[model samples]
Target: MTDIPPLPETLQFTADGLIPAIAQQFDTGEVLMMAWMNKNSLAETLATGRICYWSRSRRSLWRKGDTSGHIQKLIELRYDCDADSILVLVDQSGAACHEGTRSCFTRRLEIDGSISEAETAYPTKIDESARQ
Candidate 1:
């Protein structure tokens, strides 16, 4: 069995003592989104079993799935081999994007490198009406 990794002893937080965390879906293994996290937010997230983020624009901590009910149930938190990045795998509920998309990765890129937003991954939600 894969044991849960312990929080690193030499974790290198930024000058502001914050780190960026990338969240992905555990089942589909698709990358979902990225967010910032401070030490306090990290601690609280593990302690409370909730995915928390450091909101740079708001300069505060926010628990995912709090506002829009798009909560990420923590499946695992992983550290890169270099210990510089964190990956969070989760069972996400509702839309993962603030734009009300199921994932932030709703755009499709052609083999020729052209890009286009296919459509909303999520069909209904608050941001939907606002977008239309």
Candidate 2:
């Protein structure tokens, strides 16, 4: 694997020292989730080749899928033109959402100012055999 480039010094972080990061499926182009990251978490993700995010509510570093076994392997890291946001291309092992779905973006905003849950073609369902 190629080494990740060093974090640019020109990155513009928020006043709270955080930046928004969006995770996308590397091959399929599915948007998984968006999270916050700080300098430390960003560095950790690069070094480990796994996605790491900052938990604002918990006030700590959150390694993706640490407890759920839904790890996100980093394929590439990118930054937007604004330098204030990041996009993480990853190979997701399982459900990226804590809700046990492949992605967190299941809700869609309709043009009529209504919100709807997108239909799931292959919803993640618990396999009873796996518990055996």
Candidate 3:
């Protein structure tokens, strides 16, 4: 079994004790979404090998698939040189967005300033049980 590392004490957080974490597809490099992580949430994710984030609005830890069922299985975890941000490489199952989209970045902003859908952008149907 791979050894799970502890949360780094040198990691940086915002004044509110939150760090930005970007989730991406491990093999495809497709960015799924960005979320905030507190120390507790980060620790839990490291321990469980499942993605977890701090829900600022809910004031609680948000496990990626607990509600949506579009789980993000951790493949690798990385931190920027600054140690202020995180990049979570994952094998995402089903739609990663709560809106049932494959990625939260499905919309593209054109050079002309008009918003356009990405070439392969289509939302997968989420299970009814997954809806809030």
Task: Identify the leading candidate in terms of lDDT.
Answer: 2
Model 3, TM vs. native = 0.84
- lDDT computed for candidate 3: 0.86
Over all chains combined, what TM-score does candidate 2 have? 0.83
Pairs that collide in candidate 2 are none
Q: Flag clash pairs in model 1.
A: 65-70, 65-71
14-129 per-residue lDDT for model 3 (tens digits): 99999999999998888889999998888878888898899999999899999878899888999999999999999999988887888898887664799888633445456888
* Residue 92 lDDT, candidate 3, scale 0-100: 94
- Against the reference, the lDDT scores of all candidates come to 0.79, 0.88, 0.86
lDDT, residue 110, candidate 2: 60
Lowest lDDT 10-residue stretch of candidate 2: 118-127
Model 1 scores worst on lDDT over the 10 consecutive residues at 120-129
Model 2: per-residue lDDT, tens digit, 6-112?
78998899999999999999988888899999998999899889899999999999999899999999999999999999999999998888888888889876658
| Winner on lDDT (1 vs 2) | 2
Q: What's the CA RMSD for each of the models? A: 9.3, 9.8, 9.8
Assess the local accuracy of residue 132 in candidate 3 as a C-alpha lDDT between 0 and 100.
61
TM-score of each: 0.78, 0.83, 0.84
Model 1 per-residue lDDT tens digits across residues 1-132: 123335667667889888889988898877788888877777777776678899899998898977888898888888777666788888899888998887887887654799878564333235655556
